[model samples]
Target: MHGSSSRIVGGDLASVMTREGDKVSLICQTDGKPDPTLTWTKENRNLSNPKQGRKHTHLLTLVREEDAGEYRCRAENPHGSANKTFRLVVQSTPNHMGTMVPLLVGLFLLKVFFCFLLILATFWFSNRQKKAPVMREDTTRG
Candidate 1:
């Protein structure tokens, strides 16, 4: 008797963010004693098969707000069936990371600048300590 099992590969089963007019594909790979058949569904409705293979990728094109919802991928074999769920989130604005790139770069540059300053200071202090002190006459002599 074969048992049906499925697994999500290359991606976590969490909310995926995408913008409008973007292409999105949800990936699912299954392993079973008997090769499991993969099917894609959204909101309990069957979705048109996209890329077909042991690893199924449900292709979503030109995504809109209405296209965002719970997606399920089921792998069924002779024995039993297993499924996994993923969420799609459509954002009106650009990716949050896009706005943060400049900030991150500035912070990185600041860190590099501080590091350079620290190295220069260490070198300067070490070189100063190596130099001998100048001899001075005893001014307190009677």
Candidate 2:
């Protein structure tokens, strides 16, 4: 029986966009009479050891700006071979201070309000104590 040529299960050549520190997966499914060997490359450089077969999916965790580039997946068997290309684009993370500024301001204002209440409570207690002694003296004289 003649073995069928290897082919990608899905159509190839895709562009992937993600922010820095995001996780992404590049898939390369293969179909053939015999299971095909798979390999992956980034910018023409091998991702793993040449002898190792990386089949199906290549996962990237905590993606960085440097990880953005052209990637390729190749499936090969005795009968034939197939290739798929992917272009990864990484975007910068949004400014955190845009949200943090408001949060910080809110916390500062809350602290100031609590301090003002504490000061008023201290003044009231001191005045009450001073009047307590005066009232006791008047009652004693009467």
Candidate topping lDDT: 2
> What would you estimate as the lDDT of candidate 1?
0.79
For each of the candidates, give the backbone clash count. Answer: 0, 0
Q: In candidate 2, what are the lDDT values of residues 2-100, reduced to their tens digit?
A: 788878876879899999999999988788767788888998898864322335788999999999999998888888988899999999898899999
Q: Which segments of candidate 1 are over 4 A away from where they belong?
A: 1-12, 49-53, 94-142
Residue pairs with colliding backbones in model 1 are none
Give the TM-score (vs. native) of candidate 1: 0.55
Q: Return the TM-score for each candidate structure.
A: 0.55, 0.63
Error of 2 at 2 (Å): 1.7
The sequence of per-residue lDDT tens digits that candidate 1 reaches over residues 1-142 is 6355544444436578999889998888876656777788899898865333478777889998898999988877666667788899987756789989999999999999999999999999999988969789999998
Worst 10 residues of 1 by lDDT: 2-11
